[model samples]
Target: MKYLAALVIALAAVPATARPQLAITFDDLPAHGPLPAGTTRLAVAQAVIDALKAARVGEVYGFVNGFLTERAPDLPVLELWRAAGLPVGNHGWSHLRLDDVGAAAATVDLDRNEPLVATLAGKTQWHWFRFPFLAEGNDPAMRLAFRHELATRGYRIAGVTMSFGDYLWNPAYARCVAKGDTAAIARLETSYLADAAETATAARTDARSAYGRDTPYVLLMHIGAFDARMLPRLLAQYRRDGFAFTTLAKAESDPVYAADVDPSLPPAASLRERLQAMGKAPAPRTDYAVELATVCT
Candidate 1:
């Protein structure tokens, strides 16, 4: 019994170098949330770029919703991301949720964004498609149709392994900044980092439970003011957890990410959801309402 106890302690002491890997990805690029007081799109993008560079993250994938460009024609925000060494992908033209618009409409949306992506990304590959709202469709048939279309079109589905309700905090942060609520802003920052840490832990737990080992994680974040603000600290948390950042392409290349897809299967929007779909228990939910209610209505 003492030998077994010693073995357990030894295992516990083993370093996290054997822990799962992770890749950072951003959606709703060029812009995401309403700008906080005294912030511009350029500033937000620059903050994100600088944070990633400082962390030594080699590449990040930014999925774009082309419609935003129609509003701000002069910024060349996609070019900024490309120039900074991030690749762009299609998140549809208007960020259509497939379940709402159907596969046919989603196809149109994808096509509408392609020319702009081609122009912006230049020779860089831009074949990833992240489902808007992570909803493929409510109908199995439509879901299969969409998946088949994506396969034939040579687009890989960008799966999300980790996310918190980071999007929820953006507008709240913007409101806090607008009102000069320094205390509220501090609370927002603390809660956001906590949420990120919790979700990253969840991703590690769920991946092991589902796959019998760690899988390379694809973390989903948006390009927003608060996300930019929290990014450096967030990356530091991952570093402490023994994660080494890589690109989305490299993460997806892991064999564990090659989990078989059943076209008829319902939407497995996230890694946790995918595990649940396979009848496994994922990490217990991380509640976002507690954080959002503190600052946002």
Candidate 2:
């Protein structure tokens, strides 16, 4: 009877089709800016943590910028994130763009954040590195060189497969709040949630085209006032779309990570661009900046 039970457990592990999976990751941690009036950074962090807890998310990673920690040491923001049992990775010291700063300078920026994360993470592994502005380098040679540097430092690149310009809304939302424009704020909320759902659909389409199956997806978001407010609903919508919350490690375990070639570009070549380079046509993404401009003005 024990043997039969063990066999049943092993059989259940096999997949007929990839279970729809999504891993949430935040950039510009500790503080991301455009804070609405009357909102403290700690308050923003708590709101985000509460939303994640309510969603019952397993693991959501936050990429930290060391500069922010130095500026806001009084606020135990990183401590709050650690208290929530979430792992934080390096997002570079000043969030400098690799293409703009060059490979050598960028490596130094990463180095600056290492000690900070080491201290904050304690016994936890802090080996993931995300590119600022998603800029790798100006060319393939530079890109590979930086990649080698990361490898030498025992760091894995945190690649993102899903994002819908969620970062663009914070400043606009803050503006609306400052002006007491309730109507514009309402419009921003409605559009932001709808765009997030559409972006998830677009990401899934790219995965199907690229790998003929669903790849565990890494979603890029920011630590911002607006993001904290919307995350709960956004996650609920993802559940309705058949996705299960997952860890960054589990999400990257998909074979696509090992096989997909990094596109030859300087910086900010999104998943859609990468898919297009591989000869797959992905759906168009909504222009968040343009949409925000309408309400912001």
Candidate 3:
């Protein structure tokens, strides 16, 4: 008992900054991919919101493509999201790839999404922009030009530092549910958690190597049905791993995210990007794509 009490006191003396911090953000709100049987868009949003609230996660940003809301049933998903006090940001009007469409078309697409975001995010700062597919263009000059464009529009680029391809599991999960493949769904659940844990370790290792410390991380997730189902457990796992949840704005307030938060600085480089710039290899992670693709097929 004495040893336990001493250990608790020592840990309490450690600063909050010394602990790993993570901000969770979801993309493709309103609609992501094919929904599982009997699952409504509103239900998915509600489940995700409930999970975040239950975990006491602060102000998670859900990037929206307003195009999805054109389908009448999907529009309420955004309403429910905002009603729950979550913030919405622009994910392009149609989730266009800037590289494929060029800067002119991409900027127009971005502007088209602004009004909906403005309406939903009334009195809140909604100028954060997350690139669809995280593609900033195929060349440096093109990327810089787009960065300048975003900067002029009072937008901050949301940089992703931790991701595990959570979207990949959704389709497989939907398929398994449709087919009533209970065993396959069980396998998917186990693999999903395992991959998340492994990727997190790899991201932390890379960050420490690149920055000589564990910087605050922004984890990119999708608002798919499977995500809603797994989020509560996922939040528990992150807590068990000793991560304190933070808002995107708070996490990006760190100096490491300055470029992302201020587009005028330069194109943002994530931890892996910094490692590549330094001519060092990033930590290796398991590739679950092939396995995910085959599951429930």
Most accurate candidate by lDDT: 3
lDDT of each: 0.79, 0.80, 0.88
**The 10-residue segment with the lowest total lDDT in model 1:** 259-268
Error of 3 at 205 (Å): 0.6
Q: What's the lDDT for candidate 3?
A: 0.88
Worst 10 residues of 3 by lDDT: 7-16
TM-score of 2: 0.88
lDDT of 3 by residue, 1-297 (tens): 554354335434434476799999999988987799998888998999999999999889999999998999998999999999999899999999988888888889999999999999999889999999998787787788888889999999888989999999999999999999999998988988998998888888897787666778899999999999999999999999888999899888776666788888755455566688899998888889998898888
Question: Candidate 3: TM-score?
Answer: 0.93
Candidate 3's displacement at residue 231, Å, is 0.4
Q: Quote the positional error of residue 124 for candidate 3 in Å.
A: 0.9
TM-score for each predicted model, relative to the true structure: 0.87, 0.88, 0.93
In model 2, how large is the Cα lDDT of residue 135?
72
Across 1-297, the per-residue lDDT of candidate 1 in tens digits comes to: 554354346434434346567888899977888898798888888899999999898889899998899877424777788999889988998999898889999998999999988787788889888889988677878888888777777788788878897898899999888888898889888888888888888878886676555667889999999899999998998899788887788777654444222222333345556577789887876687765756744
What lDDT tens digits, residue by residue, belong to model 2 across residues 35-128? 8899888888999999999889977888999888777552399999999999999999899998887788888999989998989898887888
Model 1 ranges with Cα > 4 A deviation: 1-17, 73-75, 259-280, 293-297
Query: Best to worst by TM-score, what's the order?
Result: 3, 2, 1
